[model samples]
Target chain A: GDQVEQSPSALSLHEGTGSALRCNFTTTMRAVQWFQQNSRGSLINLFYLASGTKENGRLKSTFNSKESYSTLHIRDAQLEDSGTYFCAAGSNTGYQNFYFGKGTSLTVIP
Target chain B: AQTIHQWPVAEIKAVGSPLSLGCTIKGKSSPNLYWYWQATGGTLQQLFYSITVGQVESVVQLNLSASRPKDDQFILSTEKLLLSHSGFYLCAWSHGLGGATGQLYFGEGSKLTVL
Candidate 1:
């Protein structure tokens, strides 16, 4: 069975502060995607990386296949960034099935 | 631009009752559809996925079944629901192929509360 573990289960940040959330895989993954679930339970896909790194706005993500791990870095955190962040690892096994990490709850306060 | 829609924002049902949830994708042709469940204090668990009409694959069977009646429509149903079925259900779609195929666009989830 494939497993994805996320660290820093919860985080609190002041506006403009920064931090990183990580996901480690039990098996090699072909790619990974990060998502933020809002209060309305809508998921916003932030990043999808097959390898290396990708950046969008104040968020940056990196995936190291050889290391079987991925990281999401948030810079200049804002109150709007408060939500539950999850990382889903896509397995190359077949049909691109994904294993999700227990989300990291982030709250950026004023 | 593409959009995904899920029906019935929330529901409350008694145990042993039947249940059905639906999802539809618009502005995308034959997209890969998926159903995911999230329990309280738990992670997202993929339940089913469909690549085309009339075909669906179950990932984790929590005593529920799914069907793809049309190219853009997916239905999840159970003849008898249990308390364990209470959770948040989400509908998602992806490009279905290519390197970044994992990138998913999700719809507002449907919450189920079985009493």
Candidate 2:
């Protein structure tokens, strides 16, 4: 079984719309990090949450360690937001090694 | 704050040829380093990790090997390349401390094509 699983393998949204991406962990995680892979294949870190929620610009993320799940929300989507989003969880075993999800491909059409 | 650097932004090698990729970390000492491979439209797979110099651990060996010859450098290599080895290789590092919730910083990544 996968340690981390992401939902909606692919998503499409019109400009000005909003949507959310979710990641479910099979085990307890110490922390979660969200990233967005741009067209150039460079990954940009969106959020790093030990717990609770964090927001930046039109993006927001929440990490529920007890529930073993995390969510990334995009508001008022723009074309520039189109990319593959990934969530990785670091276990509490002190290894600091992360298990990454398969990622969610998002497309914001104008 | 720390920075990670991966070399040879892109590489192309024929099957049976040798391969090597380099990564270096700056502004951090004894950081935990990792090597990851991402296939086309697939998930990122952990290949190797190192906690300190001269000690490397293989997580998912795909006929590849890694070395941490220095405190801040990690290298991934293979004696011979396979067509299936083509993909994006990422180098990452993090602060290795218990209960220290630091984000892993990744380099620009190296794209390899084993033709």
Candidate 3:
């Protein structure tokens, strides 16, 4: 079984619309990180959360360790937000190893 | 401030050929170095990690080996390249603490094409 299962493998939103991406963890993860990979193959860190939630600009992320899930919400989407988003989780066993989801491809159009 | 650099932005090699990829992290001393690989349209998988100079650990076995020659340098190589090895290779660094407690910074990545 996959350690991390991400939902909505692909999404589309209008310029001003909003959407959320979720990752369900099979194990009890200690922390999770969200990333946005641009067209040039560069990964931009969006958020790192151990518990509770975090917000930065138009992006907000929440990590629920007990429930074994995490969600990244994108609000007021912009053209720049069009990219592939990924969530990587670290379990309680070893922090050195992080498992990544298949990723959600997001496209924001006018 | 810290910056990670991966060498040979991209390369196209033939099967059975030898290959080497390098990563260097600057401005951060004794940072944890990691190697991640992603196949075309696939998930990213951790390959190797090094916490100190001359110490390397493999997280996945894809017929590849990694070495940490210097405190800030990590190198991935193989004696023979396989078609399955073609993908995007990324180098990342994090604070000495575990990723479970801190953030991980990544480099632009290197693209490999095995023909």
lDDT of 2 by residue, B1-115 (tens): 6788999899999999999999999998878899999998887888998888999999997999999999999999999999989999999988775536557788899999898
Report lDDT (CA) for all predictions: 0.90, 0.91, 0.91
What's model 2's overall lDDT? Answer: 0.91
TM-score of 2: 0.96
How well does each candidate superpose onto the true structure, as a TM-score? Answer: 0.94, 0.96, 0.96
Worst 10 residues of 3 chain B by lDDT: B95-104
Candidate 3 lDDT over A39-71, as tens digits, reads 878899999888999999889999999999999
Global fold similarity of model 3 (TM-score): 0.96
Going through the candidates in order, what is chain B's TM-score? 0.95, 0.95, 0.96
Query: What is the TM-score (0 to 1) of candidate 1?
Result: 0.94
Candidate 1 achieves a global lDDT of 0.90
Using TM-score as the yardstick, the better of models 1 and 2 is 2
What is the DockQ for all candidates, taken in turn?
A: 0.58, 0.60, 0.58
Best by lDDT: 3
For candidate 3, give the docking quality class from DockQ: medium
- The worst-scoring run of ten residues by lDDT in candidate 3 chain A lies at A90-99
- Candidate with more favorable, higher DockQ: 2 or 3: 2
Worst 10 residues of 2 chain B by lDDT: B95-104
